[model samples]
Target chain A: MMDPLLHVKNLKKYFPLRKGFLEKEKTYVRAVDDVSFSIRRGNSFGLVGESGSGKTTVARAILRLIEPTEGEVRFEGMDICRSSESEINEMRREMQIIFQDPHSSLNPRKTVFKIVSEPLIIHEGLRGKKLRRRVEELLETVGLKSEHMFRYPHELSGGQKQRVGIARALSLNPKLLILDEPTSALDVSVQAQMLNFLESLQRELDLTYLFISHNLAVIRYTCDTVGVMYLGKIIEMGEAEKVFSMPRHPYTKALVSAVPIPQAEQPETAILLEGDIPSATHIPSGCRFHTRCFEKIGAVCEEREPETYCFPDGSQVNCHLFKSTALDDEAGHGGGSGKPLETKDR
Target chain B: MKPVLEITDLKIEFDTFEGTSHVLDGIHLSLGKKDTLGLVGETGCGKSITAKAILRLLPVPPARLVSGEILFGGEDLLKKSDEEMKEIRGRQIAMVFQDPMTFLNPVFSIEEQLVDVISAHSNRNGSRKEIDRKEAKKKAVALLGEVKIPQPDVRIKSYPHEFSGGMRQRVLIAMALSRSPQVLIADEPTTALDVTIQAQILKLLHELVERHGNSVLLISHDLGVVAKVCRRIAVMYAGSIVENCSTEALFNEPFHPYTQGLLNSILTFSKRKDAAQGIQGGIPDLIHPPSGCRFHPRCSRAMKICEIEKPSPVEAEKNHVVSCHLYPVRKVKSF
Candidate 1:
């Protein structure tokens, strides 16, 4: 197998929660705590989680839009997290992000040409007719005509605006693109077009993508590898098809069941998790998902968090059920708990 | 089965500075009692406009219902006077918008908002002596409880901003259901929410409508959301019902090219990870729409007939209807 294009090891980002008269530091909101994964060259890695699940934070951390507090991020064997100021600036040319909200991402004052050409001006030092031609070429590549160059962001529809955003990201000729919920804000019909464009662009440009979305359907369709996160931890990661088809973690199963199958006559009885997601500042003891988990084991689950266990097929799951079986054999208990363990957290 | 709300040949136009935007043209939908009808369309496809037209809630100067009748309980809602419509608005037909913050008053407490909505259509007359504010407050709390808001007693006293985005939406839903309207119009109800919250809210709406024996007209841009809640669906394009069929039929065998493109676009995580395809090109300008079929410019299977002629709705089966030239053989025989 070829070497992975990007490797992330124990990536952690914690936002400070400040309060009081002096605005003293309180607790930290563990946004993207200890997430680790890699994306192969020309392949897409999808990060799936509900809102506040740190999927966006993970994407932002990869782009270095915000710095990571701990861990390593290697792009093509070079540690981007450890790079100097000048080195990081040059490295940005190879990594770019497409924001979820197209309207807010683009500068309202700038024309389409200026928005698309800005990256080239700063990074490549191209100017005059040469740059203008490149801008038009990029726009055309994304399906926009030359006439759209003069128009501002407000003139375009949601789908067109998104295409312009895509055009801007492609302007830099980045090796990897971080798409943060790119199509969640788009209409279903327009979303399809964007997805197809992304796929084709990947083939033509040999681009790698780190796609972040809460939509399971979108993630399933676009990603080669899928990571399911909850409370800043990746509970499951594996081949997109295998993980989705046979989700090892109960949370992954619940999330997959949540998505409405387009035409299936009998909708599956969703593994509905009762109660709202707990506050990140005050995370539950032991497993982060134990409060909502249906197959939680007894005191062991509440006392000790589960670690990732790799399967023969390269699938990895961070769940007590998978861990407890291993522990039972080690302890010579002969795999007989007899019944499903009821956790104290529940 | 007679439909509780029937909109026939509905046409709406917005007079903007640019030109007259033919927003909704020849829209026809029928919502039967206790049945859920999904109004699926892209942004600016007039799904919201159609919903506003039903309650006569379209902003006056810019929006005008050019022609057609919106019949509710055998009466034309389009012809209803402002006073008559006010009586029917919350009592017979209530609507929950996408953003609860925009619809909810920031300064007002949840209790005040819920009570105001209940009293607006309540039969209790202007006798202050007979009307109990405490009773109304209790009813408000109960309504909140029905929507599954925890600690409804305490939460009702808090302002809209105090609640999370999902909780505020629940509060809005509670207010809409306070009067126990026969029909509820949810326009992108879960668009702004997270997936888990969206799932919870969708489930709640489905349960509430069933328990109350009320019908729902769910308008959403996401087909996934619609498939989860609605039994039947109406696919709208360029302000007209392009296809109407059961959710099962629409997903399994979509007759219209637009519907097929929409289904193919949705990325199902359990399926293959090939990038979902999107319909090429943007929706045409409503003011200067295409001469015949609005989707002709982007459609891959466009025919010569689609260029110059509009297709009328042809009944494909007992209740299924589609408006497209491609279904010519079925149209000629059915029509």
Candidate 2:
């Protein structure tokens, strides 16, 4: 088997909450807790969940943009989570991120040429005409014309701003790019154009992507493997087809079924979860998704936290349903290497 | 079903610094008594403008209605005076906007806002004094419960900031239906909401419309969202109503080139044919759209006629009407 490029093991990020000024009763938000996954070389691994499901937190933790409270982020076999400042700075050159809101991420005052060329100037120390040529080439590569290189972020449309954002991300020629809801802001027509461009760019540049999105359709189109985050925890992770078509965790199934299918009658298998997502500050005791799980059992699911059950394919599901299957086959091959005890934080 | 609201040849323009931008180019649409009519389009396609025009909510200096008549209950709403329009705004028709956060007042409690909405419609016949504070609060509680907001009694005291996006939208829905208006204009009501919350809100709207016998003018950019509740659908492109038909006909057999492009653009869970190809190019600049057909610039099957002259409405099917040169209306047989 080929080596994984990005191995995220048991990543956790907790934000402290202080209610009162006097007593200082502190509680943890548990933004991203116990998320473990590995991206094989040149493959796009997607993280999908609702707004407060902690998808963005996992992405930030992997990039070390926001330092994780616990666990290891091994990039190209080096543990970047605990790396030295200089070592982490070196890793930053290889990994770049394109934020979700282009309107916010890109500097409003910076011109397109300046925005795209700043990375080259800082990283490779290119200046003057050399920097200008590289910036033009980058813009042309992302389907933007050379004329747009002088315009500010505000002057461009939503789609154009996103293209500028892509051009700036690609300027560094990074091996890995984290695209966080890249097309959620654009219209359907513009979103399609952006998505096709991303796919072509991936093949052209041989880039690995950590795609984070809530839209299931976009995730299905872009990702090779998918990780379903629920309330700061990765409830399910597997190949995109396996997870989307036949999701092991109930939360994952509900999410897949929620996306509306076009040119078809109402989906027969629509799993509409009844309640609103609980606040992340006060997460549920046992299973984060047990409150909304369609296939939830009474006692076991609501009591103990489910352990990660690994399949032969290295995909993991944190649910008692798969856990029981493992217990049933405990005698065979000594659990058949289906338990992620080595990587399990719990 | 009796036609409750009708918009005929509705043309509007915005006076920007650059020039006069023609926003809605002769939009023709109608809503039945108890049907959901979805005005679906992409951004900058004049879907929201059409909704705001229906309620006469567009600012006067900026937005000018050049040639159009919004007929509600057989009377032209365009001719209504300011006082008369105010009377008709909340009593006859109510609107639920896109962003629930901004649509609702932050400082006002749920009870205060709902009661204010109830009391503001003072021209509703002799029922003005009948709805006192206590009675209005009771009705607000009942309305909140109808929209499926939990603990209505206690939550009514909480401000809008205390509610989630879904819950805030539900509160807006409750207020929109407070007077039980005949027509409800929901302008992308669930666009800001999550998918799970979106489903719940759509379900709530469906149930409310079913029970109350009201009409919904659902303006949304998403095709699947309006398909969930809308009986009749209209696909708009660059201010023109490209296709209008029953939901089944629109989904099963789309006619216009732009409509076809839109249907193709929807990213399905199943495999995409070839690479995913969307309608090429951004929406046309409304100030000076394409010479003939608005969508001709990006259309795959665009012809010389599509560039030269705009196609009129063609009744391709029993109730389906499309505006395109490709499918000419067949001659009616009288054998």
lDDT of 2 by residue, A123-208 (tens): 89998888899998999999889999999998788888998888888887888999999999888877877888899899999999
- Model 1 clash pairs? A192-B277, A192-B278, A193-B278, A217-B267
lDDT of 1 by residue, A1-346 (tens): 6667788888999998777668765789998878888788988889999888899988778778899999888898899888888998888889988999998998999999989998899888998999999999999899899999999999998888989999998988899999999987887767877887788899999999999988887788788888899999888888888888898899898887777666647466887766677777877888888888888878877877777665545666778788655454444322322111111111
Model 2's CAPRI class? medium
The TM-scores, one per candidate, come to 0.91, 0.95
Q: Could you list the iRMS of every candidate?
A: 2.1, 1.8
Off by over 4 Å in 2: A327-346, B122-124, B273-275, B331-335
Q: Candidate 2 residues B77-160, lDDT tens each?
A: 999998898888878899998999998888889899988887666435565565577877888899899999888999999999
Fnat per predicted structure, each in turn? 0.65, 0.41
DockQ of 1: 0.58
Q: What DockQ does candidate 2 score?
A: 0.58
Model 1 Cα shift for residue A210 (angstroms):
1.1
In order of listing, the candidates' clash counts read: 4, 0
